[model samples]
Target: TPIKRAWIWHYQRDDRKIFIKIGNILNLNPSVVSRNFNKLERQGSDPDFYAKTSISERPRLITPHAE
Candidate 1:
């Protein structure tokens, strides 16, 4: 679930937050992870639906590295 954990870590950041440097978090293959994270970020569901299926509802362990 490294990727899912990573997503949670990133999700905790507020949009008001901007970074000059993102640090080593991007150590993974960028192209693939970026694509997948985009998929998660794209879930523009209504608050009620999104609330029903919160981040905690995600598969507890997902190591979906494209490599």
Candidate 2:
């Protein structure tokens, strides 16, 4: 549910906003959220690996709207 809310806040298109939103919801420090986000970014760098992994196979927390 937290990730779901985080992803929704992500729609705001502001990293600071998303971080603050997630931090507030999780009661985490901004640094902690930044660290975790950094980890995700690192893992996501390898698109092929990420796509091949179970994480990529999980149902999306947010669905993209049809353009």
Candidate 3:
């Protein structure tokens, strides 16, 4: 659930507001990545696209490299 967790973690961050390119999270084709990002955009809970959590409410989804 890295993708989902990433969305939550990204949502929580307050200092840096950079868009988490789907390419960086998923290993799918560009089309799939774009599609997923777009899908989130269409939803009200679009974490990767719009970041849906406040700093106090964000969950931390650590990247693999860190572990």
The prediction achieving the highest TM-score against the true structure is 2
Give the clash total for candidate 3: 0
Clashing pairs in 1: 1-62
Tell me the spans in candidate 1 whose CA falls farther than 4 Å from its real position: 1-27, 43-67
* lDDT, candidates in the order shown: 0.31, 0.41, 0.37
- The clash count of every prediction, one per candidate, is 1, 0, 0
Per-residue lDDT tens digits of candidate 2, residues 1-67?
2343334433443467665665676566655565455444443333221111224322222222211
Order by TM-score, highest first: 2, 3, 1
Model 1: per-residue Cα lDDT over 1-67, one tens digit each: 1223433445444442211122124333333344344344554322211111124322222224332
> Could you estimate the TM-score for every candidate?
0.26, 0.43, 0.32
CA deviation > 4 Å runs, candidate 3: 4-20, 46-67
Give the CA lDDT, 0 to 100, for residue 28 in model 3.
33
**Cα distance off (Å), candidate 1, residue 11:** 6.0
Q: What is the lDDT of residue 31 in candidate 1?
A: 39
Better of 1 and 3 by lDDT: 3
Looking at candidate 2, what is the lDDT of residue 57? 25
Q: What does candidate 3's lDDT look like per residue over 1-67, in tens digits?
A: 3455335344533322223343444433444443344345344443333222234323232334443
TM-score of 1: 0.26
